[model samples]
Target: IRLRPGYFPFVEPGFELDIHCLICGGKGCSVCKYSGWVELLPCGLVHPNVLRYGNIDPDKWSGFAFGLGLNRLVMMRYGINDIRHFLSGDVRFLYQF
Candidate 1:
């Protein structure tokens, strides 16, 4: 896992969560796009404006958020190549689980 600076609209300070490529074991590979990292999610502190919109006071509260890409997670976890297999309305693939 690696933590680096990032940015997102909804958060004041943002971050990206990338895991060491399971396929490459931290080595550069096609699966990791030769960067050796698989981007999985994004996180950050809640923006004050966003918090205000939710009826929360920025001065009184602070928090962080993470956006998980389920598709990516599934692909990484199962080593899936074609995203269609997961999004396809076909039940055949679901049966594998």
Candidate 2:
């Protein structure tokens, strides 16, 4: 996994998390854009403005946020070639998971 700088309106310090491509085992693949890495998460410390908006003391408290790319994770785990399969209403593919 790797962490790289990122941006989000609600977060002050954000990072993008990436993992080695499972489909090609870090060699290369279209899924990874031939970079051998697949983004897994976007996470960061909560911005002070967000905390203040929630009536929390930004100076006295801090928080963080993260979102998991479940579909991507599953795709990497199962070597699925297309992400649309998850959105497709086909039980034939959905049942496998």
Candidate 3:
């Protein structure tokens, strides 16, 4: 796993979490875009503006947030190369789960 700097609207010092590609075992593959890594989530400290908008004192109540790519995680878990398979509405694909 690795964390890289990233940008997101609701967070300050945002980061993107990535893990070594499971499908190809870090040898590189189309699913990982040949990078040997697949992004799994975005995370960071909550932006002060967001806290202020929520009527929370940012100075006193700092927090963190993250959004997980559940579909992506599942894809990696099952070695599904294409994400469209999950949304295709095909009984063939649905039956496997």
The number of the candidate with the highest lDDT is 3
**How well is each residue in 1-97 modelled by candidate 2, as lDDT tens digits?**
9999999899989999999999998899888988999989999999999999999999999998999999998898888988888888999998887
Error (Å) of candidate 2 at residue 27 is 2.8
lDDT of each: 0.82, 0.92, 0.92
lDDT of 2: 0.92
Taking the tens digit of each residue's C-alpha lDDT, what string does model 3 give over 19-66?
998998888998899999998999999999999999999989999999
lDDT tens digits, residue span 1-97, model 1: 8888787899978889899877667787766778888778899999999989999999999998998877866766788756678778789889877
Query: Which candidate leads in TM-score?
Result: 3
What ranges in model 1 sit over 4 Å off?
28-31, 69-73
Q: Locate the minimum summed-lDDT window of 10 residues in model 1.
A: 75-84
TM-score of 2: 0.84
Better of 2 and 3 by TM-score: 3
Model 2 pairs whose backbones collide: none
Which residue pairs of candidate 1 clash?
none
User: How far off is residue 55 in model 1, in Å?
Assistant: 1.8
